[model samples]
Target chain A: MIGEARIVKLDNLTLLVIMVGTILAMSIFLPERFLTVTNFQSMSSQFPEYGLFAMAIMLTMITGGIDLSVVSVANLSGVAGALVLASHVKAQAMGISPGTIIFLAILAALVVSLICGWFNGLLITAVGVPAIIATLGTNGLFMGIAIILTEGHGIRGFPEEFLFIGSGTILGIPMPLIIFIGVALLVSLMLKKSAQGFKMYMLGSSPLVTRFSGISNNRVIVKTYLMSGLLAGIAAIIIISRVNSMRPGYGYAYLLLAVLLAILGGTNPEGGRGGVLGLCMAIVILQVLQSGLNILSFSPFLKKFIWGLILILFMVVNYYQTNGWPMRNLVRGGVKTGAS
Target chain B: MISKLFQRNETYLFFVIMAFSFFVTVMNPSFLTVENMFDLVKSSSGMAILAIAFFVGLLSRGIDISFPAIAIAGQYIAVNALIAMGVDSLPLAFLISCAVGTAMGATNAFFISSFRMQALIVTLGTSNIFHGALLVFVGTRAINTGKLPHCFKAFGHMNVLTLARPDGTLYGLSVFAVLLLFVIILTWFILNHTLLGKSIYAVGGNYESAKRAGFNIKRTLFFVYGYIGFLSGIMGVMHLSLIRYSNPNYIVDTELLRVIAAVVIGGARITGGSGTLTGTLLGVIMMVILEKNLVLIGLSSYWHQFFIGLVIVLGVSITYYQSKRQNRRNLLFTD
Candidate 1:
């Protein structure tokens, strides 16, 4: 019993170490600035966008599918949000309340993001295409649409009130960070305690078993995508509000980062495992690292360079631990006698 | 009947290529002029070379999305050596550039194969690394090789005649196009006739069985990725030669997706195994023609991506449906 308990304790410690390592690294690298309130505030606030994306993707990954198109949808939503707000500026100038306009803008973003996610889900389920391939196909499709809409230009001029959400804080807490925490809490409960969550994990692990047990695999797959899409919508809003501009090229940078966070946070890319709590913590750590590196006066290029190395290191480590190393052997063992 | 249908897979792609050629000629009028066709083939040669590299990865049920980033990095090293370091030797700089690309590819394969990481995830990570390295190498701007040795310039620009016209109208073909075709034919030949190629298909078709059959799965994967890297290295040299300059900010933009789609369109299933080099060449031609015509006919560049996506969806769907139908028809006729 004691050994079993210790093993359980180790599971949680993984998150603790990741979080602590990030914090410790930040404090060491930017001793004066990292520990300060201002930098902490910025770090916390930036976490929500990536954190939310991680959450959505984690849900789908738990069900044995990948959504490479989330970043593209986020980018499109950001641009769409800006385009909507820009068009409504004329109405705002004529004394329409700014709050109403912002509300509509967020609504537009949510709808667009959900539609994009649904599009991904629909194709994968209906056409029998694999998630990675389907998402990749749509990644190009959605990005194409976004680019066409933007004409290779950025959408700008969002209301200040919207910007405040991205940049605002309440009682020493940034709004985006608050959303990150709140979303993580909500999703953790949904995945851990909810029936739908259980079904998703089951489906991810064994579609046949789930179907034999009378579960709707298609529904589960679609719902996971929808959840991913919804969260991506929320992330898109945060990104737009924070950056104050939107471009078709917006989320290409964040797409892999989102996937890295999800995978490193312990979510299995092949599906059937992982939780949002670990993922949330991982995104925070990554954001903190990004912020610390930036504050340390590292050039953006260097930051990208180092960040990539770190992601690769983390991916390799995570992959080695879970997949048991020597991927060739894993493939050989798992796929015996199918074609060869 | 199924055998006949499978035999015609090559023919089907050939017809599609011809149809696209006809369409392009109709739209641009001068699209089929020898000069224009030669330029088209030359421009597409780089993408075709990279597509071959991409084909190897897809064949192994893996992906190498970092090719463009690797290409840029290779170009950066070559330019830096030739222009900044004042290296007068084109061959040396070119060789080093390819070596860099191969090194990057080796790194990706090592982590992904040894560490058991997802190929997509590993390549995605290294793609950024290569991108960052390029920025650092070029110092946030494009590197110009105008002052480099003349032989280097000729590698990208110099055209040799293959078949001249009686009227001296330069109806000859581009040597670069021939080089690209040679590479494609070599790839086809090796894939069709080599033990290594057969092992690759067996591994991709089913890794466990291949291993049980005594095939070295890791080694095969490593070779596939390594070859991909080598091809990218070659493509870097070709691209530098073709474009005559290297831009640090040269975004792959949609090139990676196109290459992947081209592989799939060429009858390579995403599930691995069962891919043909002939289909890949046809896919490359189809993509190049569509892109070339779209640009020549004055469509928005943004539309190029949209059409490419549409073509990929349609191409894959048609090939898949045709193959499925052919299988069913074979069963029906036999019964």
Candidate 2:
């Protein structure tokens, strides 16, 4: 039992070490302003958007699937909310009360997000399309709809009350950061203690086995994608609130970054393993690197290159650790058929 | 006999293309004109090259989403080199661009086959790297037609065959259209007649069995991805010539999706080992017709994406149903 516990925590320990190492390295090489309170506040505020996206991706990846449509769904959800607010603003200018409009806008965003998620679920489950392909199709579909709705422009002029959820601070902590923490805590609880999480892991490990156990894998897949969609919805709310605007192409760059964060956080791409803590640590490490790079005045293009390199490096490391070294065989040109 | 003919996915695709064309011609009589046909084929040539690349990769149970990025990088490098060197030789520029593309493809093949990583994710990471490199090294400036040699611009608009229309507009076969034909024929020959092509099919069909049968999996994978890169390089040059400009910020994101959708709609399985050049050609034509007609029929260009998405889902569903029926027949036979 003790050995098993240690094994379970191995990834967590590695992540913690990486996080601390990144912070120490950043502090040493960067200027003194890197560790300032204002810098920390800004970093915290920015990291949550990426963190939420990573969490959204992690939930689906744990089930041996992927969702390429999360960013599109988020953009669409935000677009829906923005439209609602825009119309409300127009009505308020004409002397209509805007009190309930904000709440209604939030509700509309969540509903649209859920519908988009359900569409993904339906495609994967009922239509029998592969998850990646299904989500790829929906990514285009959602983005196209968003473009048509916004007429290829951004919607802005959100009320202050709506913006407060994204930028407002409570007890010296940013609201977005708090929301990210709350979602992470809730997801950790679900994965560790919930029966549904058990089913999800089993499904990922072996779908046939899970099906034989009579657990309705289809239902679980739908629910998993739904949860991913819901997280994207919440992230959209924060993003729109913070930016004070929404566009059809917002958060386009975040898609790959979120995937990198999840995989770097020790979430296995092949599934049946991962945790929210590792994800949080990975997000923090990336945020620190990003912040440090900014302070050093590195080009944004270089940042993308670094992120790509890091993703590939971590994948290579993970492969070596999990499957043992295959370098010799690779050089010898020998076929190891069952290695994978 | 009818059932056997209908059983082939290509048959359905061909009919769909025909039906769609007929519908569009009815909606807008000018859609069926020879001038529009030439324009359609010219526009689709670049996409056709990429679709063939995607088809070959899918046939081998691998995917290279980085081909578009490779193409963009190739164009950036080639155009920048041409402008800087003041080289007027179009052939030399094309060769340089293809060389760069092949190098990028080789990098993808190295990581994928050596590390045994998932091809999709590996290509995704490499794509980011390539795009970033393009931005950093090439910058975001658009190289204009004025910087290109006069011969290159003439080559872009050169017609192999021309016919005078009643209204005095010349309808002609574009050079890129000819290139696309050659590529299709070459790909077909490689996939059907070559030993490497057979090996690729076997590897994608069953990895362990292929290895047991003495196939060089790494070399095959390298050739597959490298070939895609080579094709992408050619397409990149062609695209630059056609548009008369090269920009790093080109609409590559949508272009990649269109290629994938065309290949998939052509009955290529994402899982690998089954697809044909003929079906892929039909798929490409179908998509081009659909897109062109959407604008002709008074819909906004934005709706084109929405319709393409719908087509992909519908095509995949049809393929799924056919496969399900095939599986049921196999089960009955076994029992």
Q: What is the C-alpha lDDT profile of model 2 across B190-229, one tens digit per residue? A: 8999999999898888888998999999999999999999
User: TM-score (0 to 1) of chain B, per candidate?
Assistant: 0.87, 0.94
Per-prediction TM-score: 0.89, 0.94
**Candidate 2: tens digits of C-alpha lDDT, residues A32-127:** 879888899899999888788889888888888888899999999999989988887687888867767788889989999999988888888776
Q: Which regions of candidate 2 deviate over 4 angstroms? A: A1-8, A90-99, A326-340, B167-169, B325-335
Each predicted complex: what DockQ?
0.38, 0.49
In candidate 1, stretches whose alpha carbon ends up further than 4 angstroms from where it belongs are A1-11, A92-97, A323-340, B1-3, B6-13, B82-90, B137-141, B162-172, B295-298, B316-335
lDDT of 1 by residue, B68-102 (tens): 98888887777677676666676786687788888
True contacts kept of each: 0.52, 0.47
